[model samples]
Target: MLDIAKLARQMPEIGQQMQKDAQASVKRLEMAQQLFFQANEHQDNLIKAQELWCDRLIFSPGTPVESLDTAIDIPEAPPSHSVFSSDGSQIAPSHHEIIYCYLINIGRIMLHYGQNLHPLLDSIPEIYYKTEDLYGSRKWGIRTEEWMGYQRTLKEIQILTEMACTWVNPPGAHFNVPNLAMTDGSLAFWFLDTLPTEAREEILNPVIESWEQLRESKIPIVGYISASRSTEAISFLRLMACPYDVPNCNNYCSLDNEKNPCQKVEPLRDSSLWQKILQPRQRSAIFRSNSRILDFYPESQKTHFCYLHGGAEVARIEFPQWIAEDSELLNQALSITLTQIDKGFGYPVALAEAHNLAVVKGGDRTQFFSLIEDQMLRYGVRNVGVSYKEARKRGSIA
Candidate 1:
């Protein structure tokens, strides 16, 4: 009567279907966004109030911005005054309107790492390296040629800085709100060995040299933000990149992007929240009357599990009993926490291995504790620990 094998055989297919469904959902959202914005011809204050940092150019596919000598698209735009069309329709440029380069499309977010000679130093350092075991997990290292990744990141920084230099900071620059270099990666440091020595000096010399001047003069600020997998990393880097040292403070856009796809973040504690508050945006998708689409719970959401492995470079804290709790309030909290850990769940956060709270027993509590501890260490987690004795006293079983 046992059908274990039969059930096992169907899981892969089931997983594949779920993946397709998730992807489909993403596509649908993208489409809806386009339709909503375009329906009003970029008006209506729904989507195009302000240019999105990386929303798929909802208005038009990017075209080569013609010559910089003639690059100021809105010459009519006053330096600080809001320029209006002859028809009086508002046509505000993106806040990031660097005169020389416009962000054509936002590429995927990438993590940057660094080394204090520790892969997952139990204690976080003040800086990260692009190759220093991203997120303190071996699995997270870029698979491409280390040199190539180095070159690519370097190039990205250079291009961005150049954009700032010519377009954002150029003489007669339009609006000035401090030049913020929002990157998920490390801002100041890079892996030199991965790059040819000549390329290293050539590419980084400008950034280093120019940044030093900015650091000294205190007129324009360059900030480094590292909100990668580690909150400690963020704190640590923020300290290292002191406002004077690197004043900009990795303040990326706050108005709810995919990293924080949910707009109505309860408690709204993430660093990004402060960013949204500080740099308020209206007539843009980042802020609106209805709030971000993230607040509305959608049906057909998929749940994923991360098999908790102990002592891993990145470890998550979860219990084998949350799902089993009988308390109404406790159960709700448990479900929310567990769903947050789902690899497929919205937003990125620390993760742990999956434990079927439904099936685990009080007897297996010791093993569970051991598992959690080991997984945590392996993943560079030093925050929480599993207490088998506590579990046992509470009659916890495997």
Candidate 2:
């Protein structure tokens, strides 16, 4: 159905554009690298850069905070400990299918490392199919896809929190050991950025409640980013180079390069900068995030992150500010995280297994739809069928 001839004609132009972009990128990269090395070597300058970021960096209306610029060495992991991870996969609402429903499957894994590898617990998939969950009505007050996606994110946080609580206070056994609870990505609820104030609050309130439950459980939970391109560190450099102290400085700073001391590192990612400095199993200083989303988070749940090297590429590991304030818990979190990364060869083993458990195969969906059709027939609604577009996709072989 595609126009191959037209595509072929455009290929040469596309290739030329890509080449030009690549060359420009290389030039900027070299400049960023030079600035990174220069800043890393000069402790006095690094300190100054941090101060400027704290004092003048343009943060969201209500989010103005200081930075924690102390880089602690990676502590050794204990010989025996437990690590738990959770991941979720979703089946989005389909317009082509006879059934208009979505499903979210969360897979959780708890692994204990002592004399040998031991699996402690694994959870069965949780399914929801109530009247409120299946339909998109004016009464629901939100679009079907938006509501379903938001539910999936909320479920992930809730599941992680529930698992952490269960581990801390089991019905049969009691153990007083330090363990780490982790999810696959950043803890910040990114969905809020796309919603209106009231709609955002509806989702955010419950998510924050779940976070509070996890915090009260006193278990260290981390959001692991294997390969990060965040510019939080570079933002510090920009603040150091900022020309004016006024709230709105973009108009003046862009042209006043002479006054901007941090201009050389204007556009650099934190991971790229750390890749040059951190050794295997090393972690950079923990820094508080000035992300606008933090303004909505409860005071106890504000997020902070650190750059780490776990025998692979540099990554960003994020946690709540509460964890960072506690020395013992922070060390435990850093140590266990490094252990998981080493075991999985740069990725966390628990998260990998969780993903594997949560994945929904194509065959599974086909079988599931077939079962739904059978149920419909039993209910005397046999005439319901997939859309014509879906039927055409399954054309006869002969």
Candidate 3:
């Protein structure tokens, strides 16, 4: 059990430390804001810095697609449009359970605006119990949880693509409405970096295929991240602050750490910088991600992102290069996103609804295990049991 009394005794000291940290953070934010405006004024110089040192920079910084200071107000959405979103939930395989198995549940939603059509909401659940499914090849060295997560992400996009394709070619009616497809988080498979080359190819190939299908169907898809802590834009500012002719962190900073000039704008996120620059419903300039994983991705499917002030907070929206290059599609995507945020009162309604449908509560997990045990007993399986630790966690003797 937690020692509440001891924790209470330390609250005063914790509060004081937090207060001091907050003050320091405020000072850093002020310095960052000043540097941000200065960088904006000299966008040309920053572009030159990127040209000279982009390949050698240690940190991944965003490459601007347009002027660095560009901020565009949210465009008006089409009169009639559709929005499709998908989210996934997973029950990881655990040893304490009645069975060594896992489940993936994908919740998909479709919403139509300015039309009298009913919205579609449903979840598809799949179970995997085979040894090959549970533990992949030993040579891959991928953890079960990471592998399951990658599978879930792949399932989410595939489902989104299937739903959008159906919308594009409905059975009875011709739905001529412009549409947007979205998922819950970053589209870039950054975690694949941990896997071997063959393992990365196994996971990435299908995802890229789905992206290609969406592109062929002219359906714009995005990944929305709320209160994002990404520092790509801040890293760009650091490039602007480099006083040396060639911006090399390792060559100079490793020898003399105290004199590093970029530390002036230390510890501020991209969202913090945009919060000061963007008004509500405005979006900052789109920037291409410099993730090394994109080297494996096709040029057209490379990840690009922008920050939008969605009334309540700054949100990072990521999409493929195709959407980033098309003005009409980009505007349509941003407008629909802002509209969804308005309807959901800060977050996208489609995503929020999909999350509601995908989430597996504690009660549901308990019931799932109960169902498994009951089935095992019905089949006269004697191996069914729970770990002593699990049993102790379920009940206590006072």
Candidate 4:
């Protein structure tokens, strides 16, 4: 376990001890690093590393895909007849089918899945697909309903938790049947494509196996990640470690991504790990900073960069690389939601977002700051203070 106390104390002295090295590590926080791919032999072996943990290795059929054959017989029927939308427009937003319950805290967050007429300040509505009469009365023990006006969307709530548990929990992280991997989207595929064969075998294969099994069985995956930011890492660990809080200790986003824009890929730069991978110019183009790389290339977007074996091939011939524009899509949101308060030196800013998962993609990690500012402006409420427990005690069913 990472000792937050030690990290906090040691952080101040790092620059003095190791100036250049510390600066380089800090520079990595910028999202413009290149993805490292292993040699052919290493690549082949990485695919084989899952002999122990998992039964077999495979990619999940996320979006429907029909692959081309060697013989190239009359091409199979396409997954979608046309890439355009109903209105015949080319651009179609890939609806976020999965929900990752990233920052759920029993103390900070109040989750109400089943019907219980209570609307705490932090209350979330879980919409149920079925009606109350069918099971609310007959199967009261399992499916009791209490007109949860605040939590009218049970299915949505359940799925969000499932997605959260899937990404954070590692394979075999919990004895209970686990949510192994995330929805293997284009970003993941692109990340996989850039991995070195050695790293792929050692670190990624087990993860890939976890994804494949979940896909085959329709089981949700626990997408595990560790925090890139120190503050976030501590907060996440604290919430998850508490027995009464976010169950399933899913450590998300601490792994080394060759193409991670946030981290400067210096150690492996020009190393054998990046042999025939993306070109240097293309590397700069794709490994951009402060852009939502996932949105840039989405499975729901186009056949942009989602090509793999037995899938729609997006090889180097068609689309050379994945590039992120200098677009701060959330800038407007952040400007409206964040607030400044008195603190030492300058001031501290508090950011928060209401419980929402449907349209809010990529967890509420970045949105909270944007949201807090917006809520304060509305209703002339600078800040309506409410604790987690206080919200649950509210009498309103909302």
lDDT of 4 by residue, 7-105 (tens): 898886876768877676545323112211111223223222322212221111111111211111122222211000000001111112111112222
Summarize candidate 1's per-residue lDDT along 243-282 as a digit string, tens digits: 2322222253233454322211122221322222122111
Model 3 weakest lDDT span, ten residues long: 251-260
lDDT of 3 by residue, 52-107 (tens): 77766667788888787889998878879999999999899888777888889899
> What local distance difference test score does each model get?
0.28, 0.73, 0.86, 0.25
TM-score of each: 0.23, 0.82, 0.94, 0.20
Model 2: runs farther than 4 Å from truth? 1-30, 33-71, 115-123, 126-131, 135-142, 244-247, 250-267, 396-398
Candidate 4 local distance difference test against the native: 0.25
What local lDDT does model 1 show for residue 378? Answer: 83
Q: Give the lDDT of residue 216 in candidate 4.
A: 43
How many backbone collisions does model 3 have?
0
Top TM-score hit: 3
Of the candidates numbered 1 and 3, which has the greater TM-score value?
Answer: 3
